[model samples]
Every structure is written in C-alpha cells, then in structure tokens.
Target: MRNVSSPYLLEQLMSRLVAPDAPRLYTNGQPWRDARGRGAPRHAVETEFKAEHAVVDLSTQPPKPLVVKCLVRELRIRFYAVSTIKNYRSAWVCFLRWYRGPLDQIDQEDIREYLELLVAGGASASEVSVTLSALRTGLDKFCLLRCTVGLVSPRKSKQLPVVMSKKEVQRMMEAARTLRDKLLLTVLYATGLRVAEVARLQWSDFDFDRQQIRVQLGKGKKDRYVMLADDLLPLMRQLWRHTKGVGYLFPSEGRRVDRHLSPRTIQRAVKQARILSGIGKAVTPHSFRHSFATHLIESGTDIRFIQKLLGHTNLETTSLYTKVARMKATAVASPLDRLRDEPGSSSESSGRQPKPRPSVGRMRLEVDPNPDSNGAYAVTLGVWKDGQLLPLPGMRATMPRQDWVSLQIPLQDIWEPTLRCLPTAQRERLESPEFFSQLQREVAKRILRIRDAEPFQALKT
Candidate 1:
C-alpha cells in the first residue's frame, strides 16, 4: 500500500491506480465507455458538466421570479383593496412588458412613451389616468426613486349624464320579461340606488317599518340609507317570501345561493328591457339614477336632500340636475316673448296716429287643491292674454281656498299688459277713488258669478 496511511489518500490513490479493465466511472455514475466500446467525446462531457452545474444553481434559486411577487406582497402588506391590487398588477405587467428593461432602472421618459402609446392605441382618458395612478402608487410603495418628472395625466372630459323621461322608465319597467327584472329596475329608480348597490342588496337591508334601505359598502366604502317607496314594499315582501325568507335579496341563480346577484347581470337585464321598450335612448341602469334626481328636482325636492339620497360627497354634484330638470326647462319665460308687441305690425308714415290697443288680458285668482305641509293651498293669479295663459309676477300666495273659488285681489299687484299699456295720466286716474269704486263694484259682480258657478259649487269644502 503506497500511501494507505490516511483513508482520503488511500481512496485517491485507488481511483488513479485502478486497472483499465476495471469499471470506469463517469460523474453521472455511468460507465465511461459507450455501447460501441469507446469513451464519450470531450464536447459531450463538457455539456454534461455544465448542465449538472445549472441544475444545482436552479435548485438553490427561488421557485419563481421575485419582482412581481414582491410587488404584490408589498401591496398586500399595505392593505390595498383587492380590486386596486388587480388593477395595479395589470398596469405594472403591461408597463414592464412594454418597457423591456429592468423596472428599477425605468425613467420618466419611458413612462411618457408608454402612456402616449396607450393613447395612440385608443385608450380613453379615464383609462390612461387609472394606469398612471397605478404606476405612481407602485413607484411610491416599492422603489426609492421619488422622481415623477413628465408623467402628466390627461385632463378628464366634463360629460353630462344621460337621463330618461319618467314615461320611458315606466315603459321599461313594463317591458321587463321577468318579475325579478321589473323589481330590479323599479328599486333602482325608486331608491336612486346604484346598480352595484342593488345587486349587493340583502333582505336585512330592507326596513319595512321605516320604509328605508340600508346600503353597506357603497361607493367610497361608505354606508347610507335611502328611502324605500311604499308602493315597492309589497313587491319586496313578496320577493322575500318567494326566495324563502333570508339571504341576498337577489341571490345568484342555481346552487350558489350565498352570493348576491352580479352587477353585470342586472346591467344586462336593464339593457335588454331598454331595447324591447323602444325608448330609442342609450338607456342604462345608471340612467335610472339620473332620472330619479332630475324628476325629484322637477318636483321641487330640495337639492341638498337629493344630494344626501344619492350619497354625493358634494352638493354641487346634485345641483347639476337643476340644469337638466324638465320643469325648469319648460317653465322658463323666454325673453323673446317679452320683447314682441303684437302678432302683426304695419310700417306707416310718421304722421299716422297709432291705434289704441285694447286691454286684452284678464286676471283672476285660482285655488290649488293640494295643500302644503301647513294645510295652506297655493293661490295663483293667472293672466289670460292674447290666447296665452301666464302667471302674473308677485301674484302667487298660499292660503286655504277651494278650487274654482275667486277672491277680490288688490289691483296694486296687477302689473302686466293691463296697467303697463295705459298712459301715465290715465293710470293715475285709475288709481283715484272714483275709478277704484267703479273697479271694486265690477270685481264684486265677477266674484258673485264665480262663487255661484256650477264648477265652484262642485269643489271640495
């Protein structure tokens, strides 16, 4: 034994001193010779050596790439919402693919180019803004670089919401193919609830006694209460009974009874109903909410109240409906109508005297049947002039008066064509005691006839 003193030295000497006929071993524990009885080539041996090293290196490395996983982990640790995480992850993935460089080394110019590319690819301003917001959030949360140069967001457009008429809403509800759809649309309109809110509704949300619906985790993650229509309560109760008492008010169809109905399903139902109803407008579920606010404004509901019902953070958002309310548009007295004198006017010589115009208007007070909260009916002085009926300014008051009943209103409040058309001297004469006495006697006769008329006698006490 030449160097057998140490076991390590003995093993090394044995590996070099083994006979050529003895089984020769390769790194993979295989015989060095091939089936043809020749040693493997140098290139083959080198390839096997490199592959073995690669396998060892990979086994010691992470299971998957760390960049995106790290990003998601950071976001989760920060308690970002699931939807927000998904959006941010999608945005970052797209950006990383487009950049084709290390994320840590990306600069503002790269971001600008990517944003411009998105716009060129037909992304809307809102979509681009969301992407930019995601990228900014990621950069702030993950990277140390505080640089945000040249990453300008596109300006959002100010677009008014589309609204449907009350009649159209009624027609759409009538056209609903299923009772569930009708109830969905009706509840949306009646409560001004968002589509998501309606979909997420639970039986516990309804308060039959209070006539209110509680919305939990509404937009901005806030909770609020909206009025429930008395007319809708019976239908809601029937629905609750039909669905077996408790759970999501509109549960997902089939065995997934725990999940609420999806917003997309509600939206599709509304869209199909709109198409069948033939309203010809771009009717959507959100259009119902818009119609609710506009109709309320038209009915003289306060803007602040509408704002609260709609869960708007600012009153200005609710005031936009004032510009679109149907009553406001129809009730506006055109300035052009005030400027016109008469239907026909003839060009005459300067010497020709103008004919005196007749007092072509009549003023009378009419009672409103519907009393206000104070039990005072509205009194309106309607002026019928030239085939047109218009309310005289400063002539509207609230009082307890019957329909068709007349009262002797003061002539001082009468101003339109009657007093305005008179000459200054004649107007002063009409204000004198003698003219006043004559006017009072004539007005008393008109009041007597009005009180004795069949329509006035038929009015409610």
Candidate 2:
C-alpha cells in the first residue's frame, strides 16, 4: 500500500466509490494503514466508473448511493448556473457522508431530521432553505425522484429594502471620496440597476442623443433602457472625455484593462459613501436601486413605466415599492386630525411634509403627465377680464408665468391638485380656447358656485 500522493488519483478514487450495490466501506478519514503506518491497507475497494440508466426518481426506492456521474450529466444537460451546480454537488456529497445507508431506504422523515440537525448547528433559515432547494434540485429534479418533496423548510423573514431619501442620495454622491465612485453611485440610483448589471455597463450602452442608458443582459438574461437625468448629462460627458469614450463604464483595477469592474468593487464604493454620508440604515448598493424605484413611485411616474425602467419581469415586482412609497403628493390626513381644532401635520412628526399642490380658484389642475424630462413646466394662466377669461398681453411670457409653474406628480384619490394643472405635454393644448373653458368649469367645482360669463374681454382683445 502506498500513500496516494497525486490529487488526480484521489479524485479518480473518490469518483469510483459510489458503485451499484457496493458497500461504501472506505472511511478515507479513519486512516487505513499498514504495519509500518506508511500508507493505506492493501485491501482494494473497487475503484471503477460504471454507467447507469438515468432514472427520474430514487426516493424510497434505490439501494445504492447517488449516481454521481448521472447527477453531473443531468446538471450539464439542463445548463444550470455554475453556482447552483456547485451547491448541488456539495449538498449531496455531505448528505452521502451523513447517511451511510442505501439512499433508497431514506424517507421524508429522515430528510426532515437532517434539516433539523442543520438548523441546530446554527444555520440561518435562508441557509437551510437553500440547502433544501439544492436537495430538491439534485435528488428530485435532476438525479432521481423528489427525495425532498413535501418537506417544508422554515420561511425566511421578509425584510423591506432600505431606501435613502433623495437628499440623502445627493449627500452620498457629494460624500464620495473619488470622482469614479461618485459617478458609479449616480448611475446605480439613476437606472435602478442591479450591482451586477451596473458593473457590466460599457461605454457604448450610453446614448446621449436619445438620453437613455442601455442595461445589457440583466437578471434573467434580459435588457432594458432607463432614462438619463438631464441634470447629470454634463457629468457623463466629462467622464466620456476622460476615458476617450471606449471600454467598460466601470474600469477594472487589475492588469487586464479590458475587464469590467467587479460587482464587489461597486458595493465597496457604495459602502464608503454610505459611511461618509452618515446614513444609519443598512445602505448596501442595492439600497440605492430600491431608493431609485421608491423615489420614482413617490414622484408621479406610472408603475408600468417603472416596471420597464427597473427591468422587472412582472408588474408585481415593481409594485413592491408602492408599499414603501411616501406618496407625498397624496398623503391623506387622518380623520381624527380633521376633527381637531388644529390638524396635526405629518411633516411635524416625520420631519417632512407632502408638497402642496398648486391651485387656482377652485379648480385642481392635473400634474403634467409627460415624463420626457425632470424639468420644471412653466404654467399658463388665463386672466379674468370683463367676465371673460382672456390671456393678458405678454402674460404668457412674463407675468404669472412663474406663478402657476408646477412639477407633474400623481396624487392619491384623497388629495387632488388644486392649481389649474397645466400640462407641459403640448403648448397648443394650453392656448386652445377649449382649454380655458374646461379650466373654468373645474375651478367652479371647487367653489361650488356658477356664474354666467359674457364676451366683454373678447371685444377688447
């Protein structure tokens, strides 16, 4: 007997240990040694690779250990993720060590006990769930029958993602120690990109003329476009000039200059900024993405549009942010507060308040629905002259122009916009005579009164 000095030889030996109906007698760890204690005993346990028919299920029906070759073959055929394959392989290897008996004799009750052992050994619920999933994938989906069927693992606690306030996000950027780190944080929040998606961003993905960033090959192997904030365009142009506009958006630190920045690096940058900005929450890089979605939800952005920007496959995934949205535009006042002599302000308790909607007379204007940019929309106000609503001379250009300007946002049903909501979508719609007529009626609703109007101002004009 000689000590197996070669790892290749050991791998070959390990692979052959699981043969059909063979007693797994070698405890490779118990130190099988000769009289000289120089090496393993001469007793040769069969070390050979044998092929078996790929069976669908071995649950409560197999007499031997898991067919390693069959499992590996099945894994490759299905093209599972590399990490998933590694986890599945490790799980069964450990399971085989724990249960020396034939795998067919094992039942659901035994699997449950093993999971309990894992829990007792200080594994988190998530870890146990992952292990259980691996078992189901290897034992049932790939290798044989579902050895893990009907066995329930503990549910992981649902925790909402931490979101930084818009101001906090700004502070984080300002707090960034380096220009590259600052830009990375900006792109992350602006696009609602996953850390990995942002890491893989290349120079060509940015389309300045169209004002959109192409997120390439995101989760689930999908791609989507996100808006580039006009305010941040100048910063990006500077970056383009610095890099001569070629290669990955996030450059790698290693000698291989062509490689994109790693996700871990982006995360490290976020952490550094988060600490410098003094935010107390668990502000990982993903938090910025959560903040991005939550902020969009708070703004009047439509959920469906948000779903597209976030590259979410389902509307439900996009809707999760609605739960965390402050809904500042439509924060409802509690009925109890209305009964009080002075209503309690939500801002006073929370250090913030919902923005007041612009209003005119009694008419509540809708916020501009057009989302081409996050720019301010100049408002047009029709002057009431001689009982006729008329545009004043140079008024559209100068007077009252700034007075009615409002940012477009959606309000909850409880709170409606009070200002003659001028939409910036089309300038012609504002000038049309019909526009004034509808506005007049909307204002009349707020006042709960109606008045007849004559054409005195039309004659003057």
Candidate 2 residues 85-137, lDDT tens each?
78777777777668766565566777887898998999899878888987777
- Runs in model 1 with CA error above 4 Å? 1-65, 327-331, 334-461
lDDT of each: 0.70, 0.65
C-alpha displacement of 34 in model 2, angstroms?
79
lDDT per residue as tens, model 1, 211-289 = 8899998887789999989889677765765687689989996689899898888988888777556677888889999
Point out where model 2 deviates above 4 Å: 1-77, 334-461
Q: What C-alpha lDDT does candidate 2 achieve relative to the native structure?
A: 0.65
RMSD values for the candidates in order, in angstroms, are: 22.6, 24.2
Superposition error at 83 for model 1 (Å) = 3.0
Total backbone collisions for each predicted model: 0, 9
**TM-score for candidate 1:** 0.58
